[model samples]
Target: MSTTDTSNSPITNRRRGTLQLWSRTLIPTLREAPAEASTPSHRLMLRAGCIRQVGAGVYDFLPLGMRVLQKVSQIVREEMDAAGASEMLMPAIVPIELYAGTKRDVDYGDLLFKLTDRHGRDAALGPTHEETVTEMAKGSVTSYKQLPLNVYQIQTKFRDEFRPRAGLLRGREFLMKDAYSFHTTVEGDGGLNETYDRMYQAYVNVFTRCGLDFTVVEAEAGPIGGSASHEFMVNAETGEDTILVCPETGYAANVEKCEIGDRDWSFDTDATTDLTKKHTPGMPGIDLVAEHLGVKPEGMLKTIVFAKIGGDKRKYVLATVRGDHDVNEGKVRDVVGFPIALADEKEAKEAGFAIGYVSPRMAATRDDTLLVIDPDATGGVWATGSDEKDHHVTGFIWARDLGADLPTKDQQGGKIRVADVRNAGEGDPSPRLPGAKLVARRGIEVGHIFKLGTKYAQAFDFTVLNEQQKKTTVIMGCYGIGVSRTIAASIEQRHDEWGIIWPVPIAPYHVVITVMDPKNDEQSKLADKLATELVEAGADVLIDDRNERPGVKFKDADLIGLPVRLTIGDKALAENCVEFKLRSEDGKGRLVDIADAVKETLSKLA
Candidate 1:
């Protein structure tokens, strides 16, 4: 007897039957989450038996979790396809040499998971595929005909996180939907910008379809190395990222990229107190020194030293800001137009500079040392480092102490520059609105899109012939959606104290039929009938047929947080009705006739 080919047969197209029996599936709900589960989503994921921890930063998505993942993936696929992007898959393991051009191996540091294959060749589990995708475009896409093509993949990515404590929010291995677009130009129709805008809208649609309330904020590309980027954030109190929002102007940005508006700084120039040096032993940090001198932190100057990454001649930068603020290294790097790192203790000391007490006047100590002061720090008569060990200078004004030293022109030969180099905080003036203040809000970053502007194209030499038949480097854009992180972030935003309140689109099942007394034939028969009707009406249904108490069944239904719930019991079934409830609402559900149970459940789901 020969077996029929079922792979291409109609049997494959048949539904696996949307009705899932509670006893037939594995959902081991727990009374408490593990000790390591700190975040709300992490705890709820464990309690609901959606996921189980295999190791730190590694998890096994149970049946219920897998269903949700599939739903999310499908939505992403639909949106991406609708946005004119082709879907493809790439290998998870990549050769280490591919990272040579961008030097992301060094940029990623220990976060890139390095490994050696059995052939003794060095490889890595890709944290991202920018290099790999660009290399692909370089080989086959040699003409403008293939220009403006966007390709994407929904696959697993690995990162060697030092401490991945927030479950799927920061995991070693997680699913992602990453897309790369290649184009010959940046503006106009069918250009990189046009494709980028489409992808941005697609991202908005994906998250919105997933029932996520998110905000799009200006963001730094970080190690991704792009000209500009934006992040889609889900607002939550337990989120890791801090977003600064201008209430009046409706402008929002992540803390790292937030800009501050103009501000007034009053100087006490009439004090006439001479600049005096004082002994301050064991007070190296700004806090300790400020305490010893009895001055507020805002009235003190904090100087930091940084070394430029590459050049024939060594160059150092002295960045000074108010003690109350922090130096934003990204802004400093942008101002200098190069990569920079904090000067090591030995490097600073070897250059005839005090490690902690290097003052703004130290810029005059060496020709290669350039001072960059925050604009707000220029007017005040502040306390600052004296370039001497265990000592500080009091009553030091920038104009009085370094009048001729502050150069008018920005250069490296013993001159000072002024710019905004400090992190913008909660109440800082908004860059968009004149007098509005930026408010602080915590948000989880679920998606990011970048205008790469030939960064990866140059690395891979990915050039295509333009309309003029001349070779030109391709401009690129990268868009990413954190597939697994979205699930966790959704839980963070939608869960209640009782359990997760999954939205309709991504909920494991649209409706759960709770059999109050599974042993009763009437209750079981009614549940099965209602589940079948609901499934036929385009709703995923789960029937609770386990030999558990009615209270346990009700609690499980609430804990899993299906969008709609239908209860079949001795009392309700005898009355030819069932209790209909929506997980988002409070208190008990009203009765619905058994004849209209399926419609009522679908309506609730809608």
Candidate 2:
């Protein structure tokens, strides 16, 4: 594929010329949003005539939406090229065999949109291009001389979302700018880290240029297994993911990967008494049981049984945390080093374990079972299950009742293990700043960069001969930005009740020449002259020459969300001045001399 170098390109100089409203363009504004639209971006896009739903989780971008999308793609392309990356296109439909090498076909599960061709061959839409890119690298590049190569593509992707909603935020079919970097080794300068850093900065530039209020936080790699990854999230109240931030320490992370910093834990062994079992009638939940036992929920141990499956082996693992806390399945998976599922009641019963009343004593009794205990649960005297129906154990000390072989200072020893396996709660210690507390906020993920060492390279055997003439697998880094979603995210971050307030860099047109009535020769002449001068001044201009009321034209101008609006009416034009207003600012339009209109618009755009 051929690549374009856009480093010297100007943002305001669009390839297309000036647009004329009512005749040359379409802006089908709606008074109310469609019922399916939920988020502000979704509702606004529908009302502004930027997009229309073709099916569930599928949308057709109208001219206005396409313009915004193209602008975003161009910015991404320029940034990638500036970072010394090449552009290439990959097929949207990939053969199923390509994914077989990486086992992503199974890993992606139902999310993979699989299909059967007429010749009875298996095919699937590309949800991601890691495997395909690695396969391509294997055939084309053969030595370290071709190392440190970064290639990117802006293309459509497909995923079979279980419940696709929130319009472009979680669409089934969407546009994405995905880049992959290959390196001969991960260590030293000018290696994987260098390329990864460049991509990271490129992503930062992309979001910032789009005028998004976003943050970079440590994130879980998920299906894209990697040593490290960071997600770029646009901050918003209605975002789906929770972001943990420590103000004092400048530490931030997604909840999935966030860690609680150091804190002191003191166990009141002086107030503890002998362990005793009491008869309880029913299987009440933790809150009810805490009330029954006259103890706080934190003074109880909540034991959960999980069945870990790897290859052909399935082992039942018991996980214990404070009753007030919840288990983080991802952390447990990491500890067990395998995929896990909640143990069914039947399976627990068949394994000689009580469904809800299982105790830590079972871990001591069975050598085959694995045990994981949260760090908070290690030094506390607490209420616990007695391993019998209708019975509870009170004052159960971790050291005494559980055989007292517990390792001091929070380390795995004997059969019991102590780790930070529960989800970090609000007010937990900040990992980066001592004595600082972690706070939670919501954000929408717009981009992700992963350090995907040799996972894909080894799968596809993408190797190169090093300087020493040794065959070495290529290390990789994958970075992605949702091109269309970035547009929606911008709206999510920068919109008011009136409409979207677009940023100057990516706005469809830098200025909108709103002529009240094109039939009026004075207004038409002024609007046409202003547009010509603005285009010459390095601004994309849109002339609203429609024969409509001033009120309707003004309303449409706001809805369409051009960065600047120049209103040319008989009143303003007769005064030898036109009203100029910025869409992002409040209040009435200010009158500027018609002779100075182009100069004023150019300055505002700058």
Candidate 3:
């Protein structure tokens, strides 16, 4: 693509003159701001003139913003290519039947934006392209030699977020590039691991080049069924989710799995403490109960109920954590290993799972119900449940009162496995760093590469003939780049009070030639000469050919955030010199001969 052709869409380029090419050009900004926009990224995106509000959750990308979007897409393409991933386009629209076979289509519920086509067939704007890519891979490639096939596409994806906030970080209508890889057997594991690592590194490189400060931390595999997954977060103080890190150790995780600090607390064995039921009025929360009883919160067993798969009834579990600690439902969900969500009051009542009085003893009754308890809850003289509303039993011991049903070393029936299911928090010990603690930060996810093994291939019956003439379905993996979202993320992670700091690699025009006095004869000639030299020096050059004032031109240039600025004025015209400035540095300026400016810019870029 030629520089100008690639710069803007045909429609936008024509309007650049009339519309005035800047965020100030009809920017959709709010005065008081909406309460829904929770993060700086979300608010700034609107003020920066990058995106427009199409609806409550949807957005439309504008001209200058689209340039940054395309640049992010190019970087992703380069990295995926380096990782041996080939590129192809897939349809944004998908049929419902393909999703029905996999069951996720229905299971996804409201998240999938479902609609009917002109033909009256059910369809979904693809949230991801696992089904579509595998369907393509299955029809084309055959034999074990073609065992590992990878394909990707950068396209717009639609997801109906229950609450879409954080600007481009989360949106209803957004851009995402999803890639899928097909493998035949376990032998493909090496390449899979290799490419996964490569993609991870590539993600780092892409984010770094875009001038974003972020963290690649451990994350849970939600919805996507896999053993390993990583989350790239931008460190911002206003982040909604709490992340715990061990500052001492450098271990990091989302707060759900963030491990609490370990301490020694001995259970009282000698005292003949009575376990009596007592009314605890108006204390619905554990913290409230702990304060009322003059005991630590950890000294009590907290029960929570969850609605499970294939039933209207809810299952209740006694979640015992020290009052100082918190619950990790992700760990509980892993144990449940079924479709389960936090149970409501109605579901709990019908299932005989009490809302206020729930106990660990009820979990093991062979009554066709499930109970998974937190590990720290066991082997303690703690306050527990009476199974009656408004009453609890203190001085209750686990092994003495309800023995053998508690979880053991093995993850088996009626046994609560000791695992971290709570949200990982910053300052918590890093699981990988041993004794060290992790510091937390926020980040916008610009790209994602998933090793989608057989999730799609098995669904589509995507099979190929092997060398042995036997037929087998190809295993697959998928990767993606949110081309448009990256621009917003880059800005979120790397912006100033003024505007974005566009990097040299992606900035639309590397050098903006500001004709300080466009009408001045010498200044105009000097500006034209400088522009020609810069263009010849392999820099994408933009001349402020508009008859605007020097201050106005400078303001627009700064707002645009180009890396290099070349100013031509009366003082430079006489000496055949031009003023050059680097966008990153403080208002420092250098006078260079008109000829040397080109050489200097080319050298710096080189």
Candidate 4:
């Protein structure tokens, strides 16, 4: 958790000199990686001997690979500390009892990597440690004085992903820095909100200092069940994610919660014409049906099938958005006022609703009926399902002739109904900033932070007595950084055909000192001088002292892409100089005297 212990670690000094430029520690380079590696990041990372596949979505990190991992972790640690967070270690193998109390053991279910111990008790490789951390706090801390406690750990997490690819970017087993904060209230004054904003600011600094070009976007808390969450994404062409962004205002968020521009349509209860049925053969879909009827997209109706909780089978919801527009499921959920999943076709058939032929009039007219009409779906006379095969009802009014009132089927008294249940598309407007419409970008998640509220604390009874001595659950927030994925992400952001271009702060070695044809005393001597000087100048240097050909050494040098390279060759000796190469340079190197070259390259790295 702290660097003080690193000084005494076995490999800190003992193995530093043993690593050879071409022979050991790492494979140096592989001529070819497997064809399965689609992106440069996956190929280079494998060819560089940083990682190897152990399972479909799991990896084994080699020594040099772990050294870079530590450097990345150290940066995260410093940033978390700067934000006044305390560091702790949590076990990778966690007991299921902790999650049982949170009632999320089943929530995780198949996504959890569960195994039984010798004693035959269920345990899991922690995907994140909210349950463990809150349980630990519950057993020890109780006073309100300890109301705000922040703890974090850099640990390996596991998930049972259905499909895994893109190397470490979405692996089943990977490294994560997850932190959870406990508070006493939900208000921004002093509780979960203060910590949430603090965590957000801390995340900004963490990604910034890591040399990562990242953006924080609004996201769902997902199975973790939190009120709000944000995802840190690195923009890259090879990225696996697609985010909707506003190019005009720099507004961005995941597709799930993206907001759109304004378009309103509402009709009084007495507006629509008489409900008349008409033939609409071969009109299985809304688009085809609208075209068959000589109607614009906005002049038609669309119904979706969804299974609500406590329902016997999937039911039809005749949500009438403008024909040109799409449905936002979140709005439908807001109408139902709870979490629900869409009902598939089989369930719809069992509910006696024709798969393709469904109408507002045909659906069961009861309090339990879900009929949510969009603002535009209400006032307009439109064409919709006739509930019979190859037929439709036109000039159908939702509120006026249909006796519907504002997304409710309770006859204006009993229960709210469900209307639309489809996902919104790219044309939607900005929910946050005005004049900003949704734009698109590919993103890969690098980090995430969530306001957990009292979910974990209340589960474990992790509480503190308020001023009046009333027992109250502590509010919570959780933060995470994809440590292993950062390596793959960095390569995704900074790489070319040659090899990886790492940012300075996390590069394994600052400089590579190549003694081309080291058998020559002159070249060896000059290389040694440069290596020593650069090391003393506070640079981590890799010295190529092997008796290899000049071509081999040069090839390896460029292939590894150390930020700076120094060559002490016969040509340099003749000029009383050394060839100075900046690996990222666009042109040939310059010759400087051996002594001056060391300081010169060091300056470039600085």
Q: Quick one: best lDDT, which candidate?
A: 1
Put the candidates in TM-score order, highest first: 1, 2, 4, 3
Per-residue lDDT for 41-127 in model 4, tens only? 878878777778887988888755676688789889988887768999989889999888877789888888888999999898898
In candidate 3, what are the lDDT values of residues 1-606, reduced to their tens digit? 235653366564232211122223443333434566656556655555556667866877765566667777888888778777788887878998878878879788899999998889999999987777666766777667875666777788899999886677778888876766667653435345556676778778777776666666566663445535666665655544455556655555565545555422333255457787778877878878777777877688776666565666434444445445666777777666766677777867776766777776666663556666555565657786677777778888866666565544543454444444455455555665556656666545555556666567777777777767888767555556676666666655555655556777777667877877667777767766666666644566667766766776666666666788888877875787888898776684788898788788767665
lDDT of all the models against the reference? Answer: 0.87, 0.84, 0.66, 0.73
Location of the lowest summed lDDT over 10 successive residues in candidate 1: 1-10
> Cα lDDT for residue 207, model 2?
91
> Distance (Å) between predicted and true CA of 32, model 4?
1.6
Q: Against the hidden reference, what TM-scores do the models get?
A: 0.93, 0.90, 0.81, 0.83
- Quote the lDDT for 490 in model 3: 60
Deviation in angstroms for 156 in model 4? 1.0
Per-residue lDDT of candidate 1, residues 1-606 (tens digit): 114455336756433337799899999999878898989999999999999999989999999999999999999999999999999998999999997679998999899999998899988899999999999889989899887899999999999999997999999999999999999888898898899899999999999999998889988864445536999999999999999999998888998998888875433355556799989988758998999988988989999999988889888988999989899888888777778899888978887778788789888667898788777787758898889888998999776777667644334333577777888899999999898999999999999999888889898888888889899999988999999999999999998888999999999998888888888888888888888777755689998899998788888888899988898877776788999899999888978899998777777777
Better of 2 and 4 by TM-score: 2
lDDT accuracy of residue 357 in candidate 1? 83
Q: Choose 2 or 4, whichever is better by lDDT.
A: 2
* Clashes by residue pair, model 1: none
